[model samples]
Target chain A: MLTAILIMTGIAIVLGAALGYASIRFKVAGDPLVEKIDAILPQTQCGQCGYPGCKPYAQAISNGEADINQCPPGGEEGIRKLADLLGREVKPLSEEHGTEKPKSVARIDEQVCIGCTLCIQACPVDAIVGAAKQMHTVVAPLCTGCELCVAPCPVDCISMAPLAETVETWKWKYPVHELRSAA
Target chain B: MISRLFNFRGGVKPESHKTESSGTPIDQAPLPKRLVIPLRQSIRSTARCLVEPGQKVLKGEHIGQGEGSLGTGVHASTSGTVVEIAPYPMAHASGLETLSVVIAPDGEDRWIDRVPFDYRKVSREEALGWLRSCGIHGMGGAGFPTHVKLGSGTGIDTLVINGAECEPWITCDDRLMRERAAGVLSGAMILRELIGARRVLVGIEDNKPDAIERMRAAASTIGDDVAVVAVPTLYPAGGEKQLIRVLTGIEIPQGKFGTDFGVQCFNVGTAHAVHRAIHFGEPLLSRIVTLTGNVAHPGNHEVLLGTQVAELLALAGPKADTDRYIMGGPMMGIELQSLGVPVTATTNCIIAASPTLFPPPPPEQPCIRCGECARACPADLQPFELYWFSRAKNFGKAQEYHLFDCIECGCCAYVCPSHIPLVDYFRFSKGEIWARERERTASDQARARFEFRNFRQEREKAEKAAKLAAKAAETRAKLPEAAATAAGTAAAAVAAEPAASPEDLKKALVAAALARAKQQKAAVTPKNTDSLSAETQAEIAAIDARREKRNTQDADKTP
Candidate 1:
């Protein structure tokens, strides 16, 4: 019985070592998924997703507390792409986050003269680079076009202006109106 | 044990919670005054809104038309005066707006017309056409246009009718299969006609013996058109790939469609929808919605389209402060934020009654050294490995373990003694990956646009230089002999400069011309609001916005 016990211990040691070695040797490095999810976010750096920023949201997505449909800025296409990646059923954007709006930038009217600077403080992307209690102007170029500043405006001076169509921003959509003028 | 050899690994094992409200007959909900019929309920594109707002729309009247071959028409759920044709809150978590034609229902629920055809005489194409015209789509959770499915999946040899209602608390399909066997068979015939497969297999789970028996009887009556196969009861066995495998002993390769195996599957309820579409030219308006879970009355009810979920809950006698509202089955269902979400074609069941339906989410804890989750995983993955990788946010290792194949069935979480919420981890990883990808794509697009814009600006500069040179040459050419001679002598001397080549001389002339052009270009700008076209100013603002946030984090991470 003693001999048997000794042999069992020897066998157990061998098996455990084999498993331990495999664990170390086969240890794959770096998850490619976080990168992919981070790529899909709007990157507006807005906490509208209930996270500190887009990267955190991407991490949260990897964690599953947030739904793929929460990025209203990314719209349906973004949700669909996320669904494809995660293999989750692609439902419409989660309504709690808000709906898809026309791409807009906040334009603060200087003449309104309130100078409350509330909108500036609320800018998630630091799009409003201005002094406190002074006439604040929106740095349109820095804005992610998130429109988060509109809500915080005290006197309602901030208005969302639909970004203009330009050659740079425009891509030829797959010609959805193919039948037009042909018939 | 034999089945275990082939099934995929790593499924979830969520509590069925079916007992909250099952084993009861369906109760009727009080009809609302206005039934808001959305034009785009099915997976297909929204049907054309045929009826203008404020017109009297009769029940079953074709109010919306299916677009081309990939659409289903919209029908009025009940006869009433059309109240509005405007955007309203849709049955989505987004609370997004959709075009809805609201009808204030009168006392009399009436259908406008019923165009019935002989089922026997209808050709396959004709039948498919009728199905499209009638506006039928898969009532299964996917809501794929039904006619599109019937349109041949090339080389298909088997038609698997999904009766494996495995999700707990959802019995609408079971009740429909048991009660309307003949209609289902007729619908199957239409499908058989749609795709001339070697054989049609009807797979009902053993749990539903009555449904199985009824379906078998229906098959016998239909003769050799369809074959009845009873698969062992298993959660998510109704999944097209899973059901197909149970019937035909085949597995769908990952990242491939079921058609690769020469098989097609349809929900039993979707078949009935097909039958309604083919027999009576009826658009898919109403469907058998399972009213169960935490409710007093638990069964199947044929609810109209665009029915408010709140009213449906009232019908079920939902408890005040019911904890959860799940659309479809608990395993794959979504949690709804509000009861105001309208019911659509894809809404098969609404679990809206129990505190037990979705108890407070399980307290998450570190996984113990237990292999229960591995044993329970249907996909045969070492979910423990996935769990470690997922928890660490090491998506690479998780993917190596076939993370994408984990169906998020909650089997691992259910079986886990530690209750790790493993699915949530996997979900989070996937979402992060997607978010990253979107950022990458937008950056790539931005980069390409920037490059193209720079190239265009360069070309414009070159063109202006050429124009200025041409103007100088023309002015020189028009000069009189003595003046022209003087000019030529000066030009020749400049050209003859020892340091200057012919190319240099040409470049110098071009530079002088370009300087002039630059001044002109600057001068040409509209000084005031009136001078600036609204279109031009808008363009300038957009360009300015583009320059501000040029670098995106996603672009830096993804290739």
Candidate 2:
């Protein structure tokens, strides 16, 4: 009986030591999953989610400290993608922050500008180009319509304008009813 | 000669209403007062409009130039003055708007400088450039650029000229072959020489015996290298892959072009255009369009590129009770939203749907999984499964079933007991998938830019901190002996951070956190409101009073 007990104890210790060594040897170095989640995000850096930027929100999501629905700029489609990735149930976008709007870019009125650099500092994507006491202009293509620069502009020159769709940017709209109207 | 032919997996043979329109010879459609030519006519590319409003353009003069390597040129069909350059209805299923140049024809069918070249004497590249400049593209349903198609015919063994005219009630190609067989055959020979092909086969459906006889006689005059063979009558047998398979007994693999198998196919009308561009120095300004169904006269007419369909229908004598107008054949056509849409190079047939002739399809019913659609699918895909997944909006599942392989032929729809509109579902699924892919690409770009911006910000912060530390060290080095001691401690505090211990690192982190918290607290303080108006000052006082009252009320409630 003692020998059987001793064999059982020896087996447990051997397995335990093997598992412990394997755990240390095969430890994951970096969180690739968080990187993937960050890539899926729209990356507007709007700060509407109360996070400083998209990366901080991604980290919070990975750590389970923030819900996927908090991103207003990302909207419902973004939530659906996050749900698919994290294996969670899809939820409606959190309405307390904002709602999804058509894509827009911030346009700064050059004529009304008082050469202040506050918007440049407020921009997360560094899309605005200017120096201190110099008129700033928003690079149209690079601006993410995050609306972060609007609040810091004391003159209120920055306004969101919907992106004009050209033929190159036009996408096929679905035919809702097969027969629309007869000739 | 290809003695034995091959068969595709599945196809349905619809009733051929060819004799309705094939009864007479081709007619020249009269020019309309105004021609609204869309800037984009080719499927592969959308040309950029070169002419502005109020500009006078001669016949065959370029109005739009190819914007990309794969695009075709757009020319003025006749001498005209540009009236407007704006968006108009396009010949698409969605009837969406596209930019067009509306021209008021000057009533003079004058020609630009016609420069026909001996294709044999000219280099292949030169010939292709001429064709591209002439706005020559396949008159087949897809409207692929002829130069692009010809460019892929290198080292081709068999060049198949598709004269099948398989769809019912569309006899444009048939009439073209019957009337201009010599031109078509000459074009085929030119194409064969250009591509350096050893064998040329002209495949025509057996139903059009007249076209077959004419094409055979024409091919006989050309060497034994060209053979005109009649293929079996099938719904989509004229499809590039299907015709290639039927003629050469070779099946192009899925998601591959016919050229990949050392075989290339061009439409009979496209061949005629090639011949005209090389021999007669004529640019492709017009094509044979069939106006049929519920019209007094159902026949072929050589309609100019920018003429409105309403004008063409007026000549064809449309019945007063016509219900609708379809652009192509009944199987693979789009219903016209308005007759004002112009007839581009791709408008082969316009069927006037009437209550007595063509009726609306019955409402859709649920699928019982009978699998008739699967059997009728020409691409050999399971249509029922595609239907289920697409209806459920499970794009991944639909993709797994190879949803894009569907040819949108409406063969399954014709045979479906449920009248499922299977092609519509497939198109919707494909569009949704493309939209998602575009969204993903945009998101990826945004992410990269955002990440780069963040990295730049971090680098700038580190550089600033390093510069500040170096400046402090430099100032300490120049300080006096009494002050140098104090400055030396400050320099040491900056330099000592390089080799910190675990305890020191923790303390440093705590100190940094405290400093950041204090900085944030300081940043929250309001400032720079010294010169406020009386109205603003009263508003601030009212807000302060409300806050004080809320605090007192909260205190009372707690007690």
On lDDT, the leading prediction is 2
lDDT of 2: 0.86
The local lDDT score (0 to 100) that residue B130 gets in candidate 1 is 71
lDDT of 1 by residue, B1-559 (tens): 1223234333443445444443544444556767877777642377789987678877888888877667677888888888888766665534556778888888688887777756558666676677777777777756787778876535877777887777887887777877888888888777766777767788876777878898889889767757777777667677777777667678777677677777888888788887777777666777778887766767778788878887777777777777778887777677776666678887889887465546675666667869998888766677888878866767667777888877777678778887677776777666555545545675554334433544676799999999999987774444233232333565545544543465754554554455557767887956565677889989988987776546554567678
Interface RMSD of 1: 14.9
* lDDT (Cα, tens digit) per residue for candidate 2, span B1-559: 6668889878899999999999799999888889989988744488898999999999989999887887778899999799999988888766667889999999998889988778778778888998998888888868888888787447688889999988888999999999999999988888888877888999999999999999988888878878999999998998888899899988887788878777889899999989988998888899999999999999999999989998889878999999899999999988998888999887899999898777777888889999999999888899999988988888899999999888898999899998888888888888889867866776666667777877898999999999999976664444333232333565347435553565644444444446557767987856767788999999999999999999999999998
For this target, which candidate reaches the highest TM-score against the unseen true structure? 2
State which docking tier applies to candidate 1: incorrect
Give TM-score values for chain A, per-prediction. Answer: 0.74, 0.81
Candidate 2 per-residue lDDT over residues A1-183, each given as its tens digit: 999999999999999999999999999887988888887788888988888888888999999999999988788888998999999999998888788988899999998888789998788777899887778899987888999899989899999999886544555444245665767
DockQ of 2: 0.23
For model 1, what is the alpha-carbon lDDT of residue B370? Answer: 95
Q: In model 2 chain B, where is the ten-residue run with the lowest total lDDT? A: B478-487
lDDT of 2 at B142: 85
